[model samples]
Target: MPRRLISSGSTFEREIGYSRAVVDGEWIFVSGTTGFDYGKMTISDDLLEQAEQCFRNIQAALTEAGGNLEDIVRVTYILPDAGDFPKCWPIFRKYLGDVRPAAMMISAGLSDPRMRIEIQVTARRSSGS
Candidate 1:
């Protein structure tokens, strides 16, 4: 199948030469999504709220590619501070539940210091995806 590009209206996606999400065949690869919502660059101070928005952004991208949270096969979470993991993990779990896909967490300074969490996801439309 020809690759399908998903844009978020975020100019950076075009400026940096990448789409918010890329779909190849039945697989969808969502880029590392930041806390910024839509075209807004403002980052929120509340980590929990920021995390929620992150997932929401992923959801919209996945839906555009013929998938949803249930289709997520793996996820990578990058956090500037591991200490905030405890506070935000439960909120992530509430969204992922037992169907939790493969996930990995790493501590690294994000592009923006105000960014507490960033997530990238891969999903597929397999019979079991």
Candidate 2:
């Protein structure tokens, strides 16, 4: 099996020495992604807006890795404030409510204070689906 790496053209990826996502055989592992718009390198202060952008970033990575949000089998969310998590549920549901992948949430600090949410996901591409 060959491994492939995906980059979002974010300077941080080069500075940090990490790809935005990696594909190993049937599995695609997307790194923890914040709300920053890579094209503009800007992040929103609103938690819900950040959550939406997080999903957008995740989706872009998944697509580049030859999969989509529906392919996600597992997901993890990290947030600095637990209270802010609830405010993002609606946005989360809009993306993963039906797919309903195995999910986990953690209260933790992020690299930047403006980032209220970070998301990581693992996806598996079936042989024939």
State each model's CA lDDT, in order: 0.87, 0.90
Top candidate on lDDT is: 2
lDDT of 1 by residue, 32-123 (tens): 98777775767789998889989989998988888888898899889998888889888789878776899999889997778889999999
Per-residue alpha-carbon lDDT of candidate 2 for residues 55-121, written as tens digits (9 for 90 to 100): 8988899888889888989999999998888888899899999999999999999898888889999
TM-score of candidate 2 against the unseen true structure? 0.96
Candidates in order: C-alpha RMSD to true structure: 1.7, 1.1
In model 2, pairs of residues that clash are: none
Assess every candidate by TM-score: 0.92, 0.96
What does candidate 1 score in Cα RMSD to the true structure?
1.7
Q: For model 1, where is the 10-residue window of minimal lDDT?
A: 34-43
> Per the 3 Å backbone cut-off, how many clashing residue pairs does candidate 1 have?
0
